[model samples]
Every structure is written in structure tokens, then in C-alpha cells.
Target: MYTQTEIIKDTTINGSEGELVINVGPQHPATHGVLHLVITLNGETIKKIEPHLGYIHRSIEKMCESLTYRQFIYVTSRMDYLSSHINNEACALCVEKGLQIEVPARAKVIRVLMGELTRIASHELWLGAMAMDLGAFTPFFYTFREREMINEIMEDTCGARLTMNYMVAGGVAMDLHPDFQRKVKLFVTQFKKRVPEFDDLITNNIIFQNRMKGVGVLSGEDAISYGCTGPVARGSGVSSDIRKLYPYDGYDAVAFDEVLETAGDSYARYLVRLREMHQSIRIIEQLIDAIPEGDFQAKTKAVLKLPKGEFYTRVETARGELGVYIVSEGGTTPYRIKFRSPGFSNLSALHHMAKGSKIGDLMATMGTLDLVIPDIDR
Candidate 1:
């Protein structure tokens, strides 16, 4: 058997029927993280793509079993760092469900607003990175210009940009910053005008369109079969938006369409995320000015303990649906914890989508899936 180092260094491994096996990542820039793929190819055509995970696994679930309920929630922020706010919300919601905590309306609205902002910020980064994967570098800078605004807002309110750790078991850690509304409104106004430029720069570009449009087509049935959620499923016209189907944290009160595209290709996924960013802006506009006055955090004991039971909560992260499961034994810390992260499920479909496709097209296919490596490895 070939050693791991040799496998990675060798460009090709001899396979049956003269097929060639190659490794795509673990350090490839296109992956956006430490993701490894063993691909079998016949010349430029891909025959199979096998994802080799665990390069960055931290055994987060096992670690959570040791930390108290209050502390474990923050660990999830590292899983999907791009959707850190939403990941924390999912864990907090699960804890609240077990404790029967009724979060204050003001806190609920704040949580939802933060979640939407996180969604937009995550999508902005994905768009830029996706463009860069396809050999366009200019859009990356353009997208970051708007994303930096959201980062500043997050930093000002939550004291951190990427992994905010702001959401808690009862509610958010604190109230919004005094200038939260004005800054959010400013972001909304500027984003609305600038979003169209995204289309002009990359979305409508003939070369980019050709690279993405029909590549990596996945049918709606296939998407569901692979347990894909978020844009990956919605791009195939799957109605899997957890916010719409199972609203939480004042999501029910907000008015926004569940963006969908039926084409089920790379372009369709691209359009789904692009449109969803607009919907996130809409959710923010509805809640930013309407935040009610009340305590930002609910009352809870300092030493929190959950009743013996199993609890689960699901949230729509920027990548897809993130489900948190906890098994409590009437203790301060969890007996067990498991995360049904979307990246792992979505990544499972890569082989199905990229089979028989050219190696050059793999970047577009994988880029649209938007797999966050830690999210999968965790």
C-alpha cells in the first residue's frame, strides 16, 4: 500500500483499466479549507470522487460532553465559522427547548436579525471565493467590500467577527449596539445598490456563465436523497428552507420569500444564494427598525442543568441545515452531543454530481456546494 505522503505527492496512482487516481486537496486553494479528495479519472473525465475527511477533526461532540451546557454552545461556532451565529443559535435553541426557556421577544428579534446578517456575510464570502475558484479574481475584492461592513457590525455588537459566540442558552449574550440599527440600515441601503454590480461583474459575464450554467447538475430527487439542504437542495427546487418550513426565533414574524431555482446546476445554486442574500436583507429590514424594548437575555440559573432527555434543534445555516442533538442525563454537562452538519451531507453528493464531468468543471461543481471543511470534519 502506498504511504499517505506518497499518495498525496504522486500526481497519479495506477488503477485498473488504465484509470488514473489523483488527489485534489487537503491543501488545494479551491477547497477553501483542508479537504482531501481521491478522484478517479479517465483523461479529463471524472469517474468517481471520494472525499477523505478528518484532516481537521477535533472530536467536538466528545469535547462538548465534557463542557457544561453553557460552554458547549460556543464550541459549535468553530464548526461552520462562516455561519457561526446560526450555529450558536441552533445549539442555544436546543438547550432552551430542554430547559423550557421562553426567550424574550426583543431577544428573539435580535437573534433573528443577527442570524440573517450572518447569512448575508457568509454568502458574500462564498460568492467571492466561488468566482475566484473559476479564475476570476476581481469579484473577490468587490464582494469583500460589502462583507467587511457586516463584519464590522458583527464585531461591534458581538465583540468578534467570524466566531461571535454571542448566542447563549436563554438568549443573546447582550443587547445590540446603540448604532446597530443605523449601521444595519446603512448596509442595507448600500448593499441594495451594490448587489446589482455583482451580476454585472460575474453573474452576467459570458465566460463565467459558460463555466457554471449546466455544470454539476443534480436533480431535485437526488438532492433530497443525498440529504442536501439550503441552496444545494433549493437550487434543484427542493423546498428545504428550515426557516420557512420550521420557523424559530421570530422567523415566523418576518416576511421573505424562500429563494429557489429548479435548474439544479452550478448556476442554479449560484442564483439561489444570490437571491437568498436579498431575502436576508429583507428579513433584516423588517426586524431592524421593529426591535421591541425588553430584556435581551432571559433569566436562568448560573449553574444550568437539563432534565434527562434527548433534545434536537435545526437551523438554516449559510451552507445548509445544521441540526444539533443533545442527550442529557440531568447533569450540568451533556451525556452526548451530535451535530447533523450540512456540509458532510452535501459533500456526499459530489461524486454523483461530478461523475463523467471534466476535471476542469470540478471546481465549479464543488465551489457551488460551498463545503466548509471543519463543518464536515467535526
Candidate 2:
């Protein structure tokens, strides 16, 4: 294991033959976070790509072991901050499973609604950032315009925009805001009209298509082997949507198609996310008007203690499947905890996808992966 200083020195050294060793991040914009990539390039052709992580490692799983069930869920929000709500939901669901807590029906619906909204918001931001990564800056502003509305809605109900720790073991922290329905409905209406503009601005552009269509192709077999999930796997025609295969929190009650594309390339991944936003909107429409008029939270004791056993729960976050596993010793705090974060798995395939592709094509491939560095580091 090389130290950080040694790794930097290694990048400056010339590889065997004419291969050049170059570093892409650890402090670079295209990474979107503190991710370091050591790429071996032979005349602008990528020979290999190695990711150096731990730049932002927070030891979240280790931290969760020391926290009570209720306290640990919030720590996950900092993992995939873009899908913070979904991350919190995963932890809460795992705790509920351990205690065999019966979440209220209204709470189930609310969880699903917030989850889908988080998915859309996450994708909207990814779309803009990915576009900007490919040198199209206008779409960044266009996409953020809609994402701001979602953030405002999140702030109104959850009292925080980025890391909303609204999800609890049995239900949400509070009831929906009085204007939640109105604001969400209005945002939906506006978003539907603006999606077309996205296509006109970037999606349908010939140059953009050329850059994405054949770049960073990963076969379905390879994607599955790398443990890819969510858009990354679905883009390769893999049926890996956890919401569809393993429904939880009223997902089985909702009607939404699992978006898939067979190309297994950057463009395919892009299309999956774009179409998925519409599916998220579909799910929201179905449950928005039908929110049950009942207790928002289930009755539970003041303190939560799980039986001596192991428990696990999985949820489909915007990036992919997030699994929370906990081992309890009949105690308030977890004996041990582990997280199966999607970004880590998806990143494992970077070398396979980038090899033999042009160095410039790296952005399109990595951008389409939509990696969140903290998620990987955590």
C-alpha cells in the first residue's frame, strides 16, 4: 500500500514503454468529489485506470456500531448525500426489520413518495453535472432550475435540503407540510413541460450522442460481474431494480415501469436515468392524492432495542441498491453494522469500461457512472 505522497510521486514517473501515468483527481472538478484516478495512457488511449480512494472516508459503518438505532440513520445521509433520504430509509428499514416493528400504512406511503422525489432530484442534478462534464454548460443551469424546486419542497417538509434525516424506524419525523401537496404538484407540472427542453439542449444533439453512444461500453455480463445495479446495470439490460424485485415501503403498491436499455454504453445509461425521472413522476402521481389520513408514525417504546440476532434491509437509492446490515446483541446500540453501497461496486468496473477507450472519452464514461465519491469512501 503506497502512501498518498508516494502515489503522487508514482504519477510523475513514466510507465514501461511509452505509457504515461497521470492523475485525474483527489482534487479535480470532473470527479464531482474527492476521487483520485491514476490512469495509464499510451498515446491518448487508456491502458488502465486505477482508483485511489479514502480521501473522504468517514468510517460510517464503524460509527454506526456505536450509535443507537435512531442515531445511526442520520449518519448515512452523509454517504450518498444526493440520495440522503433514500440512504436514511435504508438504515431505518434495517432497524425496523431487526425489531419487527410494524410501520404504519400512511408512513409507508410517505416513505415511498419521499424516496421517488429524492430519486428524481438526484437524477436531475446528475444530468446537469454530467452534461457540464461533457462541456455542455447550459443544461447544468436548466436542470438545476427544476432540482431547486425539489430542494425547496424537501426543505419545507424535512427542514433540510441536502441531508434530510426525515426517515425514522417506524415513520417520518413529522407530518407533511400543509403546502407540500400543492408545491409538489406544481413542480411536477412545470418539470413535465421542461423535460423536452433537455432533449433539445443536449440529449438529442448529434455531438453529444456521438460522444456517448459507443463510449465506455459494458456488457450485461460484465456489469453483473462487477456488481453494478440501478441505472448502471439496467442500462446493460440487467433486471436489477431492487424496488421491482424486492418491494418495500409501499413500492409494490405503486405502478411504475422498470426502465431498461440494451446498449450497455454511456448513452444507454444516460437514457435510463432520463426515462427514470418520468417513472418517478408516475409513482408520485399515483400516491400523491391518496396519502392515507392516519397516524404518520407508528407507536413504539421510548427506547429501541433489537433482539440478539442479525438483520438486513435493502432499498433502491437513486444511484443503485443500498443494503444495511446490522448485528444486535439485545442492546440499544448495534454490535456491528455494514453497508453495501452501490457506488463502490459500480466503480469496480471503471477499468473494464475505460480500457482501450480514448482518454477524452473517460469523462463521458465516468460521468455516466454518476459516481458520488463520499458514497464510495464511506
Candidate 3:
């Protein structure tokens, strides 16, 4: 619900400003998902923007309250399946905290590696989608060509491309594939070689530059108050990557730069994600050979139960911070669960960013938002 402020109504003597309420969509391709924005416009200037959500909310929190600790990990995979490893990590961390289980050193290293891979994959898909939203078609295919390698590696180990229930409470569900190291090395080599081509193809392209260069400017103050995270926050000159602030798994040992941009505009967001991918590759190469041999799954009783308490975990998803809040009642299931999704906070900035832009710029502006509706709705 919007704030309860009295309206300064101006019904009579309206200017030559043609005002009308326009519905952007529950189906607009540029919305990034089933997001419907009701905007009041006077000519090309936006007067007001209201977002109507819940088109995709399946009450995932309620469902988690019925599933056991071991079962809830798979449910979180649906929130941001592009970064399923991170989603699983959050669930596992919460359960681990509750159970006080000591995961082996091997599990932590593998989790960090997979988490970094998920981050790269999520950013890759976002890059393609954002480019396509701006009417650039060729770069999407180019980005996907590189991203397909990550999906193949995931499929071989987890048995599914997306929404893999790969992480358990104390350790991973399965051991790393026999060729995991070799395949990741190949992807690292391929990604490093292809990144420069992407810059030449889209990032440095004149048409894309014209569309994104100075549009949708969000100031650093606005970004902080809006609770933005990931590249969205980093683009606005904010350092809020959870991996850096709160290191989990093997993040503390790895050496990588946190990508930052001070422009606070659509182009800034694009540049931030593009550079972050490079850092992800750097971390992957550092840890590829360091994956130690040990038990993948920690020993736990058949029917797992968590202590009665509140468990909270904040993980940096591809888009931003995905916070999972779970309340247990000394049973197999949770009493209540709340997910603070990144897209919701990031999309809220859309109204402020697109205030005076042209209709075409609206697509360019929203593309930078990089929303996945299920994450928002869930």
C-alpha cells in the first residue's frame, strides 16, 4: 500500500498536459516477468507509477512450514533458480545454524565454488535479457552460448539444469562430478576469451550506449534507503556484496575484486554486472584445484528436526541479497518463513528512474532493473 498522504487535487483549469493512466502490463516482455505497472502520464512525463504484484506468489513460505528441514532446500530453488546454489546455501546455512552441525572443510569449498558459478550464470542470463529488452537481439545469443557451458556442468553434477536440490543441511547432496575440475577450467578459459568479445559486441556498441548511457539515474542515497543489493547497489557506488561483508564458505580465502561503479545510472548497472563476471571467473580459477576430497553429505538422523528458534540467513543472489527468515517450533517443519527478495526492492526504484524518460527509454531503464517476477512474488 502507498503512503497515506492527502491528494493536492487539481481537477479544474488543467494545463494542455494530456494526462491518462496507462497499464504497462501483466504481459509486457520488457517488464522482465508478469509485472504490471500502472503509470499516470502527462505526455511523455510520468506523474505516478504503481506496481501491482502477487501475479506469481504461490505462498512459498507457507509451503516451507510444512516441509522438513531436508525438504525445504529444494523449495528455495524456485525463488531464483538462476542462482539455485545460493538459494540452497541459504537454506542449508539456516538449518545448519539450527542443528549446530559441523560441515566438513570439503563441503564448504565446493559450496563456495558452486555459489560463484551460479553468480556468473545468473549475471550472464541477466546480461542477455537486458540487452534483448533494449531491442538488441544478437548479444543475447552470444551471452547464452557462454552460459550454456555452466548449465551443462550443473546438469552433470546435480541431475537438473535449474532448481537442483543439490545442497543439504550439513553438506552437498552429491559429490562433485569426476570431470568437474576439467569442465570448470574449460568454462573459465572460454569465459575469459569471450568476455572481451561481449564488450566489443554490446557493452561498447554505439546503439546500446545511446540507450543506456545516461538514462534511469538513481542516486546513492536512494539506493541505500531502498535496500538495494548486488550489482544494483554496487552500480550506485555502494559496497554491499554479502560475500565481502559477511564471508561464508571459502569466500574469505579467495582473492577477487568487488566491482563498483559510481555513475548510478542504467549504464552503471550494466558495467557493474559485466565486470563482476570477470571477478567471478577469477575466484573460480583460484579454487578449482583446491577442492579437497572428503564426505559430501554429513551424517544426520533420518527424520531431521531443528530446535525451536528463529533462523535468518542473508545470501547475495545474482540480483541482490536474498534473505530467508525461518521460525521453527521444535518439529520437522518451520512455524513461519519470510523471504526478502532483491527484485522487489530493486523494482521499486523503477518509478523514480523512469520519471521523465521516453517510452523506448522505459524499456532500457527497466532492463537494468533485471527483475525476475517469481523472486518478487515469492
Candidate 4:
């Protein structure tokens, strides 16, 4: 229950000879966004981690109040750009719930396909960035080589690589490209081969294991207490995958394991994402050939209106669960909008995890959390 000022007062280390105060970023390259971490250090051991955020805040929730439901979905893309497709999907699902729109079967399969691809793309980038954060740079190049193939697929199908506004209220903005299936199969084949190489290059390296394996451990109870989700919760043995729990966008039809690890350390989180990529590939393999030949989008009015009520929907994003809540007064725009984004909740555990660890260990902890700061600030 500490106020912002009180929290800062407690974390600030005055210029004492044995202690130091350092800013990790509002612009440090290792950080994913404009996240500013004020680290209080007694030599190398971390006394505290106080994050100063909001550098990229756009008041997206309030902005959603002004924009129509269909238009608001794209704004979420700018929040967690790596998981943009999933973000948009959450908002669209919420809007569709309010409208009681029954999405076409073809649209459902296509949405799931895009969701899995987005998950893999996000994890590939996370693996690269996480390795780089631990001082191994070569994996970044190798990981991005595979990630770029997914981006090519996204560009060909969605007309944009990042922040793709593909999801609509009833279904998708457009149908899948004719080449989508062929390219995804090719990428999955190559990616499956490259994953073992990642294990060889970084995952099994003694130095990498030492940096990750017992550092910044978060237990299952603490993970749930902190409302952690996605790999962060799964790493700690908390079963919190929304796709598995809620089964939206034909997720129930596809078979894939909810990747989990009980070690609850940086390496466990790393392993969760790695295995989740394989699961995503398995999901695509199941549905890519079976996409129903039907309308890609459901019939909807040009200017949509929602009945007076509250609607909420949750979806599994690359980072975690993204919940979109909307309040409507029988209008084209939402009366109030709120997004329960995973990054903000996950960031709350940073101080808890990073304290008593080395400054170097902080990188492993934060990297495993896989934070995207705009999601927090928004």
C-alpha cells in the first residue's frame, strides 16, 4: 500500500560510499521499451529495483472510449507490438461478445493460425533478446533469421509486419493470403530444425545455464499472488494460459500442450517459451490444411453499436493474458474501456524478484519476465 513517493524514498540510495544508484533505462538498449529502472546497489548485490514507467503512455484506454469498437482494436497493437495480433484479438473478442456476433468457421481457423504465428514470432524475438541480455550476442542473429520468415508471412497476409490490425469485430479484416499455408509450413519445418541448434548454441552452454538456472527464482505461490501469467506463471508451475483455460478462436479444436516448468527460475521461463513455440507449430500443423472454405468475415453493419451492458474477454498474448473490458451505453463508442494487460501485473514482481540478486542477475530476471513496457504504461 505504499504511495509512489514513499516507494521512491525507501528505494533511493543516497550517495554513500558502499552503495550506488543507477538508472537501467528510459533508453538503455537491453530494456524492451522506455522502461526506467532505478536500481539501488550495495556493490553488485541489488538492494531494490524501482521501475519508473509511462514514457510511452498514450492513454489507450481513454482513447478507446473515443474510438469506435472496430477502430480501438488496432490501438492495442501499439501497446505490445510483439503480441499485436493477440492484443487486437482480445479487443475484438470483447466487442464481438457485446454484439453477440458469431464469427465464421473459416475466420475462426484463420484467427487461430495468426494467433499461433504471432506467439512464435514473439517468442523468437524474446529468445534472441533474452540471450543478448545475458551477454551472448550470436543467438540474436540466429533467432531473428527464423523470426524474419514469420514477419514475411505477416506482411504478405496482413499488409504489415508489426502492429498488424488484422482482427475485426466480427472476424478478420481480410482473408488469409493464398501463400499463407505454404509459407507457414515451410517456416515451421525450418524453425523446428533450428530449435535444437538454439539448445546447442545457448541453452546448453554452461555459462548461460549458470546465469539462468538458479537465479531470480519465483515460486508458484508468489507467481499466482502477483497475478503473473504466460511464461512467467507457467515457469513457476502456475497453470495460467488463457488459451487453454478459455479456448477462444477455435483453440479447443487444436491440440497443444500448455508448456510448464516447476523450477521457477530464469531458465525455466526460457524453457517455457521455447516449448511453447513447438506447441504453436503443432497447432498450425493441425489447422492450416483444415481451414473451412467459408466467409472470412461475418456480416456486420458499417457502423456497429453495442447494447447497454458491460462486456469482457480474455486472450493469450505472447507476454500473457490480455483482458479487454468495455462498458457501453448503446453507442458506437464505448462509455468506458479498460485493458487488464499482463505486462503491468508481471512488472509488479520485478522488485520482489530482483532484490538480493546481483545487478547482472537482474537482467536474467527481467529478461525472463519478457516485459513490454508500453503495455504497462498504456
lDDT of 2 by residue, 1-378 (tens): 346677656655744677777889888999999999988889999998999999999999898888888899899999999999999999888888887889999899989999989999999999999999999899999999999999999999999999999999889999999999999999999999999998998778999999999999999999999999999999999999999999998788889999999999999999999999999999999999999999989888889999999998999999999989888999999999999999999999999999999999999999999999999999
- Give the per-residue lDDT of model 1 (tens digit) for 1-378: 245777545544544565777888888999999998989888899988888889899999999999999999888999999999999999999999999999999999999999999999999999999999999899999999999999999999999989999999899998889999999999999999998899999888999999999999999999999999999999999999999999999788889999999999999999999999999998888888789999999999999999999999999999999999999999999999999999999999999999999999999999999999999999
Q: Which stretch of 10 consecutive residues in model 2 shows the poorest summed lDDT?
A: 7-16
Query: 307-362, model 3: which lDDT tens digit per residue?
Result: 88898988888999988898888988888988888988998888888887766688
Sequence-dependent TM-score of model 3: 0.94
lDDT of 4 by residue, 191-298 (tens): 888789999998789999999999989999999999999899999999999988988988887888999999999999999999999899999999988989989999
List candidate 1 segments past 4 Å from native: 1-14
- TM-score, each model? 0.97, 0.97, 0.94, 0.96
Compute the lDDT of residue 159 as modeled in candidate 4.
Answer: 99
lDDT of 2 at 247: 95
> Candidate 1 — what's its lDDT?
0.93
On lDDT, who's better, 1 or 3?
1
Error of 4 at 104 (Å): 0.4
- Cα lDDT, model 2, residue 173: 96
Clashing pairs in 3: none
Worst 10 residues of 4 by lDDT: 1-10
Model 3 lDDT on a 0 to 1 scale:
0.85
Residue-level lDDT for 305 in candidate 2: 97
